[model samples]
Target: MMMFSWRRRRATRRMARGGGGGSMTELTIPSHFLCPISLDLMKDPVTMSTGITYDRANIETWIEGGNFSCPFTNQPLHTIDSIPNHNIRKMIQAWCVENRAHGIERIPTPRVPASPVQVREILDKIAAAAGREDCEECKSMVEKIKILVQESERNKKCIIANGTGNVLSSAFEAFSKPERFEKRVEILEEILSTMAMIFPLQEEAIKHLKSEASMQALVWFVRGEDKSRRRSSILVLKEIISSYPEKVSELGEIQGVLEGVMKLIKEPICSSSKKASLFITYHAIASSSNQEGFTKAFLQMGLVSLLLETLIDAERSVCERALGVFDGICETKQGREEAYAHALTMPVIVKKILRVSDLATELSVSIVWKLVKHESREDEDEEDGGVKVEALQVGAFQKLLLLLQVGCSEWTKEKATELLKLLNNLHRERLECIDSLDFKDLKRTF
Candidate 1:
């Protein structure tokens, strides 16, 4: 019993030393068994009987006991008072000593390579098997090849560049052959899916490929004999807007794509697809100033109402993007009036503005002020033409008053006051419309 106690004390001292009296020590473990908390050897490496080792409880305890966090996950340690498995602890100690002796601070685990040889072999197999003409089998093989190429690319190697480029070029070349366009489309789809995964890892290489192969694929798919292929191309173009915005912008003639996307939005066959296409088109338009023609096309397509509908999309990102487009359109005088006219029929616009809380409220209030000021200027010019003052209704003024009353931030309130002064200057008759509200109540609310 004394000998066992002494061994335990020695183990505790070893652990304390590795922990550096609560500071972290760089102790290396097998890449698979490293404890995230200490970035060192794990204690009582809890392997299931099946050889899967993970000690969630031990990890949590170590983290909590020392106020430590996992380096990868950043999760807080919550508890660490129980004894670990003795055999596993011994194994971990032995392994740590072995690694330390070899000066192995961090052993990188083996990862699957994304290489040209692997891609070339997969392409050769596909080419040889072309006589079978089994679409499902072809798709399966293409998907497997794509996955392998993606995995290799993710391993931080440039092995797939030559192979991938050749494969894509051959696939595009095959598109003009009899019964090969469908096969080419399948190959392009696989390549696109793989590119989506590997692009972040090999961005520069992927960008070049996207500008070349992806562009060719998109053009072919869009102009294909098959309607399904055309639709698929549209979907892929939308994906490019997100993954390769810079490259997509370089393609030029975005108006044609915007028109195509807008037409699809009006079709009931693919409502969600249409919405996604429009969302991407809007982003593409917002990304470039030269594409104001696309923006004008959006306005011509009754996009104001569609955009308003999108503000309440189930996807927060979609809603944010739609709002951003709306804000972008309202930046100019003509666009502001166009937006203001649309806002009059949509009460949700005001409700959405209110829901924006302080930050959004401040911005919306400022936008409203600018719109009202512009309208006032227009109203002044119309008076000389015998336009009746009473006939004109400034819809934004009442909303601004309500916004001022409910606004919570000091900045919002001060801006609101400035807006009211501007409105009085534009439509002096409208001053009584807001003065009826208790100024004291507005101040208290703020």
Candidate 2:
């Protein structure tokens, strides 16, 4: 009496009509058309050497998961490759066409992925064309690669894995030289545009490009008339410095690299370029062998002014980086003096405390500590006087207390506590000096 078989059943479907009404359609599917692994209609079905057919996606997933046995048969696989099961795919396509009324949309034919051989061949052709002074052919092949990499993540990875990164690095090494930059501007632009998309570059690919000469070439591109190339060059420079932090000193040694990088910080083209410029500025100070000289150079380039402007308005990440770089600069005596001299410096610094991020707050406190540590703390007029007085007048005292009360990183708390104590001491000294003064003995005219 209770014999219900679930194996064979006619499913009912309710589809939404164009005007939001409901329509019923029943589609009977052939089970052979379903992938055994997914148990769904197979699109781009392919047959394994095991004689089992599956959707190519399912086969790929199974192979990638380290499984060698057929899912249904548990038989060991002799080959990892699968051939396209065109007949099954055609049948599935036909089934979808027959059920078009049930919202069954046709699956477009799959594109053939870019093979590794094709990428290598194209690069080879480009190199040959360039050697022959065939500019048009060379540019065409580079454009093809740009298109290939844009097709899919798999294609991009394949291109990089096949040594596309080193090829680009080599191109930069050859074209980035000032002697070649003019005649080669078009190809340089094309290559730079292509290289921008390939990020997280391998060190071996870029290790040769880290020299002072290469950096100068990069600066040329940064200072190039083509504004777009300038941004692209900055992005590449950022990727390089980030990868080889130890070599940041090499960049500092370059005659004009600092100003070029600072220009980007001053006039940001985009968020990524600005962010990259900030990072380069940070490492230039942080990783330099001669921190004193490097930081001094940064200060003299009006870095303090740029950083103040950034802290005044840059977003959270940019603000944090600028603060950190400022902190580094303030480590040197010249840097501290420059920051202390600016009218808006201490006030803007005070404004950033606890508003941006923990790291930012920490950097702000550290900078304030450096600026105040050696200031002539002797008594002075608050109207136009001592560093401590200006800090207090700018509401630094109240912000310090709030930072301590709200809590912060241990390092930040330590700096904040010390600065707070110093400001409090200044207040105390002023009060005691007034009390000890002989002004009380004089007559009040008012």
TM-score per model over all chains? 0.49, 0.74
Residue 140 C-alpha lDDT in model 2 = 83
Output the number of the TM-score-best candidate. 2
List runs of model 1 lying over 4 Å from the truth: 1-141, 145-183, 193-202, 219-249, 252-255, 263-279, 287-291, 312-315, 340-346, 356-370, 376-418, 424-446
Question: Best lDDT goes to which candidate?
Answer: 2
Alpha-carbon error at 29 in model 1, in Å? 31
Off by over 4 Å in 2: 1-23, 26-106, 125-138, 211-213, 246-256, 287-301, 378-385, 393-409, 428-446
Native-structure RMSD, model 1: 13.7
lDDT of each: 0.50, 0.76
Pairs that clash in candidate 1: 61-79, 61-80, 64-77, 113-152, 114-152
Which residue pairs show collisions in model 2? none
